[model samples]
Target: MRLMFLGDVVGRSGRQALVTHLPRLIERFRTDFVVVNGENAAGGFGITEEIAEEFLDAGADCITTGNHVWDQREALVFIAREPRMIRPINFPPGTPGAGATMLTARNGARVFVANVMGRVFMDALDDPVRPLEAALDYHRLGSEVDAAIVDVHCEATSEKQIFGHMLDGRVSLVTGTHTHVPTADHRVLPGGTAFITDAGMCGAFDGVIGMDKEEPGRRYIERTPGQRMTPATGAATVCGVAVDTDDRTGLANWIAPIRVGGDLEPAVPTRWETA
Candidate 1:
């Protein structure tokens, strides 16, 4: 099965870009499933119900979130109802939204999508590692589920790398989010797990992690802060990763970065050519 995992979608700019071009990209790639990180979709804060619906309308099978999952007040209620919009698994026990879900692919394949947040430099929460193990156990990898995709919403590259290595050979793909800058290390791990340090943000590439540059630049230069920075209003790109898994073993066959439009370089996964 071919799965596309998009990084966090920022504000209007990110949503607009996805709504405008996602249909074409989906059709062209023949993607079977698509998961988009939407933590910042609601005007640079947490996702709102309308924004989540917008993503679903644009052909996303599931939407994942991160630290900003609860930034918007409305999310507290909307997340309770929407099973597709996932928050980090390691949030306090009473968190509104779920951290994992089993979604059916177009071909009737069961794909488990799990979302977990890292503790390193993040909000204090439950141990991320434990729930991940439980979720994976419940999903029953390769048997009860055909494939699994994990979005490690985190800030530290070292923690993300550790989680990827821990889940290697068990999950089909493990990609990082939160740090909006896309990393260059994209490759299949030794254990066949498709891994990337960070999938980047689906917002303005020119700004600081999708936020307007003016406030951040001023804060850096003047050393005196103003109001909080807002999302950049500009041409945005939908950045993500593409993973193709073997239907039988549920192991990754190929992995590639997908950066469509705006300033970043675009990429598509081709058939793996043996060297």
Candidate 2:
């Protein structure tokens, strides 16, 4: 299976860029499944039902979210109805949305996708390991599911790496989100899982983590909060990772980072392009 995971979509700029180019990306990569992190799609705060639908229309099979999963007031209602859109799994028992789901991919394969938040410097939640492991046990790849992926929505690189190593042989990919900046280290782990510290954001690279520099900068230097942070309006570089899984084992056979347009360097996943 050819799977792709896009990092967080910051706001209008990110959403527009993704909606505009996602179909082309799906065609160019021959992707079988696509997962997008949309926690920040709504004005750089939270995702809305309309925006989640927009992502599905653009070719994403499932949409994952992070710490800001409930940033928008409407999300609390719509997420309960949308099975394709999921929040962190470790949320208390009654959280509106699910943290994991088994969605059918474009190729008619059962794909297990889980969204989990890291407690390191973030909101406190249930310890992710036990629940995540139990979920994986039930959805065992190569038997019950064709492919598996976990979106480690987190702050520290250490926590992200720990998650990756902890679930190394169980899933096809373990990708990180929330830090916004793209990391250079992307590789297929020894256990055949694809991992990256941060898959980065699908928003503008010019600002601080896809936000306008003015406000974040002011707060740091002035030691006082000013205007609310907003998404940068510049052209966005769609940042993400691409993975090709083995048919039998459902483990990653190849992996690569993708960056296109805006301020960052453009990467075309030439391996697949030329394969």
Candidate 3:
């Protein structure tokens, strides 16, 4: 099974990049399933139902969110009705959206995708580990599910790493989001899970984490709120990772980082070139 996981999408630029490049990516990578984080798709805040649907239409099988999941007020209601869109698993029990779901890939493989938020230097939420364990218990990779992917959206890299290690052999992939910066540590773990501290944001690289530079710069330098932060409108680079898993074991056999367009150095998995 081949799976691709995209990081947080920031505003219009990110959405445009995704809409424009996703089809080509799916074809080039021979992807069977795709998961994307749409937490910051709405003008650098939370995702709206419309945008979430747009992402799903553009080739994402599932859309996951983080702390900003509720930044847009309408999400509180629409998320409950949209099973493809999920909020953090650690959110309060009565939260509107689901935390995990089982989806069938293009190749008829059953894939389980789960979203969880960390509690380090961020909002205090229920323990993410337990929820993840429960999800894995219900959907065992190679048995009940062909592949399992987990998105650990959080502010700290250490926390994300820990979570990834905890679910090592139990899941197919464990990647992070929310930081909007891609980390270079993309590698298959000892337990066969593909891990990356962050898959990075899909938006302009010229600004501060996909936000327009001016507003964030002023607030940091002047130490006072200047104006509302808006998404940068420049060309964007879609950042993400692709994992190829063993059909029998549902464990990652190959892992590669993907960065295309905009300011970042472009990369596509070498395996795709040969394919």
Candidate 4:
């Protein structure tokens, strides 16, 4: 099975780039399932029902979010009915929507996807390990699901890497998000899970993260919020990771980064299979 996981989508530039490229990328790569992080899709804050639908329409089978998942008030209501979208699993038990869902891929393979948030440098929530353990126990790969993915939306690279190692040999991929900057490490762990500290944001490369430079630049010096941050309206590079999993073990056999447009050098990985 083949899968694609994209990092945070920041504001308009990210949304546009995703809507435009996702379909083409799916076809070019022959991906079976796609999961996108859309927490920042709405003006670099929360995602809306409309934006979630847009992502679904553009080929994403599931959407994952982080701390900003509820920035939009409407999300609280709409998310109850939208099973394709998932928030951080570590959110208090009563949180409106679930953190994991079983979805059928385009090729008819069952795919299980979960989202986990880190406590380090962020909100303190339930331990991710337990929820992850429970989810995997219920949706055992190779037997119940054809593939599994865990999006570690975290601030610390170590936390993300720790989650990656914990799930190694059990899940198909463990990709990180929250930090807009992409990491250099992209490799299949010794246990066969594909891991990356961050998948990077799909937005302007010329600004602070995805926000315009002026506001953040001033705040860094003045230590005060002078103006609200807005998404940078500039050339954007869509970024993500693609992986091919073993059909029997549901573990990654091949992995590569997918970066396109904007200031970054283009990288569309070679196909996973030569035959």
lDDT per model, in order? 0.89, 0.92, 0.93, 0.92
Name the runs in model 4 displaced over 4 angstroms: 273-275
lDDT of 3 by residue, 1-275 (tens): 88999999999999999988898899877889999999999999999889998999999999999999999999999998988889988887888889999999999999999999998999899998888788889999999999999999989999999988999999999999999999999999999999999999899999999999999998988998677999998899999999989999999998899998889999887795675
lDDT of candidate 4 over 1-275, digit per residue (tens): 88999889999999999999899899887889999999999999999999999999999999999999999999999999999999988898899999999999999999999999998999888998898799899999889999999999999999999999999989999999999988889999999999999999999888999999999999999998687899999889899899999888899988899898788888876775453
Candidate 1: deviation at residue 142, Å? Answer: 1.2
Q: Which stretches in model 2 have alpha-carbon errors above 4 Å?
A: none
RMSD of 2: 0.8
TM-score per candidate, chains pooled: 0.96, 0.98, 0.98, 0.98
Candidate 1 clashing pairs, residues 3+ apart or interchain: none
Candidate 3: worst-modelled 10 consecutive residues by lDDT: 266-275
RMSD of each candidate?
A: 2.0, 0.8, 0.9, 1.0
Clashing pairs for model 2 are none
